[model samples]
Target: MSQLAQDRGISVDHGTAEDLPLTTNEIDLAALLGVIGYVNDLEMVFSELARVVSPDGHAIVPFCGQMVLFAELYDTAAGQEAYPDTLDWKETYPLEMAKKATWRDVEAVVSELQSVGFTEITTVKTLTQPIETAIETVESPSKGHDDGSWIVVHARRE
Candidate 1:
C-alpha cells in the first residue's frame, strides 16, 4: 500500500499504527482505520499519537468492539457448542485476551484519548453494515461474520 501510494506521487511512510514513523508534532491529523481493536498497547499507542501529533491536532479512531470479531461466528448455536470456551479463543485469537482489546465500547476509547491529552471526544457514528461487503466475510479464511457495526470515535488533541 505504501508503495502504491508512492507510485501515485503521494508521499508514504512505512510504519506501524501504534508507532508512527513521523517526527514530533508534524502531523495535523491522524486517521486510524480499523486496526486499533487488535493493538495490544493502546496506552502506548495513544502516547505515541500524542507525541507525534501537533498539540492541537486530532486523531480519528474507529472502534470495533469484541463483538465485531466474535459476532455471528460466536453468537450462533453451533458456535456455542463447538467454541463454547472463550478461554480457548484466547489462544486462537489473542486480541480477545486483552482487557482493552475490545475498547469496552466507545467510552473506553474516549477515556484513553482523554488520558493522553485528547479532548472533544465524540462518537461520530455506530452503524451496522452487511458483512459480505465488509473486511471479513463468511468466505474469509480467518474469522468471518454475517454482519457487524463499528463505532467511530473522533477526538482532538489539546
Candidate 2:
C-alpha cells in the first residue's frame, strides 16, 4: 500500500479524485472535513467518492453555511469587495474567503450533494445560536453571532 492508502484517516494525498488509491466498491465511508470549499471541482470529486464507496457506504461532508454573511462583513470591515474572490462558487466554494471564515447554507449544500448521485442525504447545522440566545442559554459573556454557522451532510452511495 502507498502513503495515500495509509492516509484514509489523516489525509489522502492523491493526484486527483480519479486517481484515488481505493478500488471501486470498496470504501465504506468518504468524509470531507471542511475540504469541499477548496476543491476545484465539486461534481467530479463527488462522482469519484461515489465510485469508490461501496453500495452500502456513506459519505460525510461538513462545510460552511451562508458564507455571504461573513464575506459581506469582511468586505465592509476590511474595505475591500474582492479580497477573497476564490470563494465565489457555492457548489465548489463560497463567496470571498476574505473573511476571518465562511459558512454554507444547509439546504443548498445537501441538495447539490444529492443531485450528484448521493442518497439518503441528511444535514445538521452547527454554531447557529443567536447572540441573545447564547447569552441566555449558555450564560457566557461572549455573545454568539450567526456568522459561524456550519453544515454537515451525510449521504449513502447507491
Candidate 3:
C-alpha cells in the first residue's frame, strides 16, 4: 500500500501509533481505521496523535467492539458443528487477530481521546449486524454507539 501511494507521488512514512515519524503539530488529520484493537497502548498512541496533530486538527478512528468477536466465535462454532468433517476447521486470520486484540468499548475509547486533549468528540455507530450472517451487509450510520458492532469516532485536538 505504501508503494502504491508512493507511485502516485504521495509521501508515506512507516511508523507506529505510539511514535509517529513526523514533528509536533505537523499534520492536520489522522485516520486510524480498524487499528484501535491491534494497538498495544491506547494512551501512548493517543498521546502521539495529540502531539503530531495541529491545534483543532481531527482524528478519525474506527473500531469494532468485543461483541464482534463473540459473533465470529458463534459463527465458527456453528460452522464446525454443521459441517463436521466437511469443513476445513482451520483457524483463520481474522479469528487469530481477534484473539490477539485488546478489546475496548466505546466509552473507554472516548475517555482516552479526551485525556489526550481532544475535544468535540463524536461517535457514529455504523455497520449494524444483529447476528453474524453468511452474507455481509452494511446499514446506514446512526448517531450513537447503541446498536452497531462497528463505530467511527471523530475527535478534534485541543
Q: Best-fitting candidate, measured by TM-score?
A: 3
Q: What is the TM-score of each candidate against the true structure?
A: 0.65, 0.59, 0.81
TM-score, structure 2 vs. true: 0.59
Q: Clashing residue pairs, candidate 2?
A: 64-103, 64-104, 65-103, 65-104, 65-105, 66-104, 66-105, 87-94
C-alpha local distance difference test of each model: 0.63, 0.61, 0.77
lDDT of 2 by residue, 45-88 (tens): 77778878888789988775565443344445455544345434
Candidates sorted by lDDT, best first:
3, 1, 2
What range of 10 consecutive residues in model 1 has the weakest lDDT sum? 137-146
The window of 10 residues in a row where model 2 has the poorest summed lDDT is 135-144
Candidate 3 residue lDDT tens string, 29-136: 998887888888999999999999999999998887656643455356554543234434454335456456665688989999999999999989865654434124
**Cα RMSDs, all models:** 8.4, 8.6, 4.3
Clashing pairs in 3: none
Give the Å shift of residue 156 in candidate 3.
Answer: 0.9
Comparing 1 with 2 on TM-score, the higher-scoring candidate is 1
